[model samples]
Each structure stands twice: as structure tokens, then as C-alpha cells.
Target: MIRFICCLILLSISTLVSAEEKLLHADFRHRPPEMIVENNRAAGPLKDVLDEAADVIGYKIEWRIAPFARSLKGLKNGKVDLVPRVIKTSQREKFIDFLGPIGHRQKDIVFLVRKGKEKTINDYHDLYKFEIGIKRDTAYFTKFDADQALHKILLLDDRNMSSMFAAHRFDVMVVLDKDSIESAFKQKDFTDYAYADYKHKQNIGIFYGLSKLSANTKVNAELSRILLDMSQSGRVAQIYQNYKLEAPLRLF
Candidate 1:
């Protein structure tokens, strides 16, 4: 009877351990100052927020690096449980449930033009006169995306975009704020690019999305609570500061 009781206790302990081990799969594409994966480990301000939230919620994260389209498809197919950074859209909402802004309060989509040309692009209409470079599979803003009149050159990534812009292949490259443009130019040793502030005016929130197919209301609630706490406590700002980025605007 003593041996039987011992066996039952061990079984209970094993079951509890197994139950507590929840494995989550997250997919992302390379986007600097936000999400960057090196040798299978994710880094950057956005990633840091996700890591802290996962730790608080007690989940083992399995990170996968893929193109933006592939990652979005994985989420819809239930192959990926999470995507660290995504701009909320109606089409995407059909496949995923968005959580928090995750990193900062707002993010901007700006036009990166050669320094001397900044004065030429005073409005969206002014952009029509220039050849614009856009990252493949990225959504800037609804109007910009729908504008068929603007000649757009689609590039594979930021590095390519910057290189082509330097080569005079494009007159303007649509880019995220400093995090992306600064990193891309620094990588290519191109320093003559400047933001055309008057041309693009879209400032939107970024979010972490959970796959609708793999929905877990309990986990979502817990993650939201933890992220909110982190934002309020300045933990989120601290992460950005570590990267030498200005503290993100706070909506909370």
C-alpha cells in the first residue's frame, strides 16, 4: 500500500508538470529596431516586450523566421500561434486577434527621400512626380497602398531599398521611422537620405496578434494584463531605451 501511494503521488506530479508546459510558436520577418532574429534568437525592443510577456505568462516560445506573407499564412492555417508585430487590418482581423500596441503608442510610415529632394515632396500629390520604392509585402497606409498613379518599385527588404535609392534607382523609399531607415542606411553606408515628413502622414499603432484558429481567451487576457502592467511600469520604455531609441509614445 505504501508503494502504491508513492506511485500515485509521482503520477500526479508528472501530470502537473506536463500540463504546465505549454509550447507556443511565433513567426516574424526581419524588421530592425523592432523585430530582428539572429541565429534563431529574437532581439530588439518589440521582441523584448514579447519575451517579457511570455515569461510572465509561463510559455515556451518557439520562434520562426519567414517572409511576412508566409508568416501571415501560417497564422491563418493554425501553424503559428503568434506574430510579434502586425499593423491591424480588417483582412488580418479575420485570421488573428490583436492584443496590445506591444511596444510603443504610435508608429509612423514615412517617405525617405534623398536629402536635397525633401523640399520637392510637399504632399501626396507631389509624390506622383517621383519613383517610390516600397518593401515587398508591406502595407504602408490605405491610401498609399491604393494609389495606382504613383510609380512604385518593390524591393525585397530595407537593405535593397536603401541600396537602390542610393544608386538613384528610386526617388523615394517608403520606410518606417528612425528604427528602420537609420538601420538600413547605416548598413549600406548611405547617409544622404532624409525623411519627407510632409508627404506621408500615417501614424498607426503596432500590435501582437494571436491566431484566431488557435484562440485562447484566458491566455489572451493574461497576456494583455501583463503587457499593460509593463507599459505602465516603464518596462516597455526601458526596452526601447536599451536600443538607444526614443521612448515610444504611450497611449495608456
Candidate 2:
């Protein structure tokens, strides 16, 4: 009779623990094949990675959608718990605990222009000839970022940046990478854009960031350890492959 009572108590404790699994509020802007905010739920391979990691860590995610700037700001201010992709910068490092942790990847920063207009940008100085579209608060190449003379149109998110570029609202647009440009517009819209002949070389690093102020920030090491294992084991690549994509190649 005592043994039966102990088993029941154990089962009750297990049920309570299971019922109290933590929920994380992860936010993303709508960038397809990476993260797609659909039906107010996060659906994409990036989300899949977080899903797998969260499951292992005894947590669930409450996906949220906001503009890129808002999402970044939220990540700092505690409205957000996890952000799947964040460009790591010295300033950002102060407020964000980049986990998995702080992996760096190398990618080309491309300047895109309207189709048939590729040759217009043959040199660095030529870029000054037109208005440019760039994401707000995003770091591009060093000089391009620091230059004060460039006529840059600040955009909030990929879709808006894309729509403005597609509409010819700007003469030249610098993209985050190949995917941002490729997925910016429909396939039929391809004829409207082309990479400029001129190129500037720089590599960007991205990370899974946890707000320093979030209550869940305590799990930083556990989540980082889990994700680092996933990254090293080729599981990260597999997650991207499931969506017919390739994982961002890591530099370190």
C-alpha cells in the first residue's frame, strides 16, 4: 500500500513538471525560406531548428511577427526572448547574449540594380550617382556604413526594401546577401533586377540571440551548448536542406 502511494505521488510530480514547460517568445520578420511569418505562426526551417532545440531544452515558443527594426529593438528591451538570426556587432554584444554561441559566417555583400543597369556601378565613386536602399540599423561593409555622402533610403524590412526596389523607387539597392535578393521578388520579377558589375567584399556574422533582460536568459549556456552541438554535427545543414536550402556557411 505504501509503495502504491509513492508511485502515485511520483506520477503526479511528473505531470506537474510536464505541464509547466516554459514558453519562449521568438520573433521574426517575414523572410521566406528562412523564416516565414504565416497565420501569425513561425513556419520555416529556421523555426524548425529552434523547435528542435526548444524541445530538447524543455520549452515551447510563442512566435511573434514584427518589423525588422522592432524585432531588433524588442530583442534588446525584453519584448522578445529569442531571435533566430541577428547580425553580431560590438554594440549588440552588450545587450544580447549570442548563443549557440556567436557563430560567424562569411557572405558577399552585393549591390543590386535594375536589369540592364549592372554596368553603371563600375567603381566605388559611381555608387554616389544614385539613391541607395539599405536596411535600417543593419551593418553593411565598413566604408559604406560610415560614409555620410551616400543618399541612402532607410527601409524597415526585407519585403518593404524589396517592394521599393522592384518599383524602381531607388536606383541602386544593396542586399543583405544572395537569398535576400533572390527571394525579394517573385520569379517572374527576376528580369527586373541584376547584380552590379562592381563588388565590395565583406563577411557578416549571425547568431541566435537571447535578450540579456529576458527571464529565460538563464538558459543561455544550456541552449548554446545544444545549438553548438547541432551546428557541429551537420544537423543545421540538414534543417536547411529540408527546405531545399543550404545552411549559412560558418567561418568559425
**Candidate 2, position 214, lDDT:** 89
> Model 2, residue 186: displacement in angstroms?
1.8
lDDT of 2 by residue, 1-252 (tens): 999999999999999987897899888777666777667776777788888888898899887777768878887798899887777777888888887642455566778888898999998899899899998978777788889999999987677777887777997888765775577676436457888998877655557889998888888889888888888888888988888876877556
TM-score of 2: 0.82
Q: RMSD for all candidates, in order, please.
A: 4.0, 4.8
Model 1 alpha-carbon miss at residue 210, Å: 1.5
Stretches off by above 4 angstroms in model 1 are: 1-19, 36-40, 215-218, 241-245
C-alpha lDDT (0 to 100) for residue 240 of candidate 2: 84
lDDT of candidate 1 over 136-187, digit per residue (tens): 7677788888889989998877667777888999788887546765787787
For the record, the alpha-carbon RMSD of candidate 1 to the native fold, in angstroms, is 4.0
